[model samples]
Target: MHLIKSNWKIALGVIPALLIYCIFSIIPIFISFYYSFMSWNGFSAMQYVGLANFKAILNDSVFWLSVRNNLIVVAASVFGQIPIALVLALLLNQKIKGAKFFRTIAFLPVVISTVVISLTWRLIFNVEQGLLNNLLDNLGLSALAQNWLGNPDYAMYAIAVVIIWQFVGLYFIIFLSALQTVPRDILEAADLDGATEWQKTRYVTLPSIWGVIIIAVILCISGSLKTFDLIYVMTGGGPANSTEVMATYMYTETFQGLRYGYGSAISVLIFVFSIVMIILANVLLKKRGNRKPV
Candidate 1:
């Protein structure tokens, strides 16, 4: 009590930011929760529809497709981005020429505007005269080139590839920083014990950065669930809605379709799904972490 009283000025300093967060972030969440139970077209008086919106979502094939596509994004991010980033981080962590330059180049995409990245990639993915197709043609791989973003069969996968490419540097920087924090003395001890690089990495380095890896996985899942801007720009959830995810679906249904309540319900489900997936990931990773090494 005395300690807190002594720090009262600090508490006073934090109160305004906390208030702002509650107003903009926390309060809106509860508002969405309330709106999820009521039917509203944004202009009309909200009608209390109970669970009808959720019921509709369950039977809505489009919503389910969005969920599936969202999961694919999550899977691609978690599996593709993290591993690639870790590998790159590991490689770059070593003493190499122009390492800083390389890191800067790798991380450039993360700092660029999402809309710009999407627009650039859209040009590259263009059916008529895209850079990718042109390159494939030059390599005598014209058969490999198809309508990259125009075809539904390949659109989502193509977006997934872009997602992986854009974010790998973010995690790469994260892992690189985490790698720097691993104790040099511990690594030296392993070296003295004649441990192979693979053995040392597996037993020492990875275990030390395991917490960061778990956090990265959770971030990837949450971010993937809320993916909108890139796909919205690149494909606009199109090529017959092949690239639609929960966030895009929510935006279209709410603002475009004007089914505010249904959109709220979708938003609520997105929140629930994010929480559930993060919890499940933590549990699974914890179990794996706890298993005795054979």
Candidate 2:
């Protein structure tokens, strides 16, 4: 009777979630792969078309541009946001005056909706009367002022800046929490041993927070890959798909163009890319963990 009850409880907890996962994720993925081999309008019959979609994607100039733009975002997120956030985290962990207030203010942006951020930044970046340009003009730096969003060259960078601004705080918080767990004695010992600030950070602080760094890297990768709202609301992949990332491209392909089959193919592509990134991240993380002192 006890065994039967335990089995029933397990089934009850697991079955519903499994069923939901199948319906939402697993089944939809298989369907996308199936459809990628075909072409179909939403209301019409799908025509089987072999590797044509994949081949076409290989030659699609816009797709390549989108890929390049995404890579740029990924690079900027890693280089611009992560390291800076870690530095901020270290500062906040020092029991400085107003530390909690600064932490709260930093993280407030993350809680705000992306659409709102996009809209706000759009206005801020407005060419003529926008706050950013106006401030530059006021400071006698009008030569630096330009139409940030309208210019194809600067649009992608502008969006990336906004994304970094919003999300950096969360990583800062993660690093701060991880920093608190480092033993105080270790730091004090390093101070006593006449270790320089740079040396102590290099050996003690970094090694202690390595795991949190791994987690932050993974999060930044995923978040960058899936970036859509800022690109969408701010640029709409625009001026010419210059700032297009996979999420926005997939969305435009699927809904804006009403090419369900092509959209599904892009969806599958995104899934494959995300999986590869996750695997690569895990491999690097494991290597780091192995090298760190236990």
Candidate 3:
């Protein structure tokens, strides 16, 4: 109480931002929650439907397929992006030639607009006159060339690869920043004790950034759950709904299908899924962190 009173000026300065956040973010969550219990098209009166929307979702096979695809995305981001990013960060942390140029090139996708990336990749994946198929033909591996986005079996995996390529750079920068914060003195001491490079990385370097890694995992999971723009632009959740995710499905249901209340319910499910996954990740990571070194 005394601390807040002493810092009243800071509190006053924070109030406006807090109010803005409440109006835009916090308030809408409650509004969505209320709307989830009703059924309404945008033009019609809202009818109180209780759990009808959620009940329908339970029996909806398409929604379940979206859920499965979302889980695949989360798995790919966590398992593929994090390790690849960490390895890149480690390699770049060393005194390597053209490290800065390589870093910039890797991060270029992150800064590029998603629409542009999607369009470009879509072209590369095109069945006719696409770079991938052309390369395969030139290399005498024409049989390996695929329909990519047009084929249901390959569509989701192809999207997953692009997702990894785009976001790996972001986590790479994050891990590199965390790596720089590790104490050099400890590393020097480890060197004095004749520690090999791998040993030092396993013990000192990774432990220093373990918390950041956990946060990255949580971010990856959250981002994967709500992934829409890139996949939407590339496939529009088509190829027989193979690439559909929760957010894209929700968009279709609410806007195109005119099931606003049902969309709200889907949004609520996304929120719940994010919260649960993050909590599970934290619990699992905490347990790993607490384990005694063998």
Candidate number that wins on lDDT, 1 or 2: 1
Q: Score candidate 3 by TM-score against the native.
A: 0.96
lDDT of every model, 2 decimals: 0.95, 0.87, 0.94
Candidate 1 is scored at a TM of 0.97
lDDT of 2 by residue, 1-294 (tens): 999999999999999999999999799889999988888878788899888888877787887788888888888888888998999988888868998899999899999998999999999999998999999999999999999998999989988898889889999999988988999899899999998977878889888888889888888888888888789988899887878888888889888888777878777777888778878987978797778454
Error of 3 at 124 (Å): 0.9
lDDT of 3 by residue, 66-177 (tens): 9999999999999999999999999999999999999998788889999999999999999998899999999999999999999999999999999999899999999999
Instruction: For residue 52, give model 3's deviation from the true position in Å.
Output: 0.7
Rank candidates, lDDT, best first.
1, 3, 2
Candidate 3 lDDT score at position 248: 98
Off by over 4 Å in 1: 1-6
Error of 1 at 257 (Å): 0.8
TM-score of 2: 0.90
lDDT, candidate 1, 104-170, per-residue tens: 9989999999999999999999988899999999999999998999999999999999999999999
The best candidate by TM-score is 1
